[model samples]
Target: MRGKATVLLVSFALFVGGVLALQLERGGVRTTLLVLVFAALGAVAVRQTIRKRKK
Candidate 1:
């Protein structure tokens, strides 16, 4: 149950991100936006790992 929900959430995120990236016309902004998105994703992953380990 949880696994399926997680997969759907991740898929939705990727789909939305791809669409937004395509809509951006400027190269610099697009690159910056991608960097920010990855940074945010990495941060979330790290936070989740730390949380799970503490339990």
Candidate 2:
């Protein structure tokens, strides 16, 4: 529960940051970090969903 909440919050922050970063430019480290952040969030979400179904 706590872990999910933390991931959700962090992902939200990262998304917001990513949007801001996008406003700055089109491609760079910020954009890459944003993509990585989204990928991380997706992985966490899928992992949690799988864990829940296993139980």
Against the reference, the lDDT scores of all candidates come to 0.73, 0.78
Off by over 4 Å in 2: none
Off by over 4 Å in 1: 1-15
Give the clashing residue pairs of candidate 1, or none. Answer: none
Give the number of colliding residue pairs in candidate 2: 0
> Which residue pairs of candidate 2 clash?
none
Please give, for residues 1-55, the per-residue lDDT of candidate 1 as tens digits. 7955785587569657856976899799887877776766676677667867998
What is the C-alpha lDDT profile of model 2 across 1-55, one tens digit per residue? 8977887788788778767767766668867877876887788778878988998
- CA shift at 8, candidate 1, in angstroms? 8.7
How many residue pairs clash per model?
Answer: 0, 0
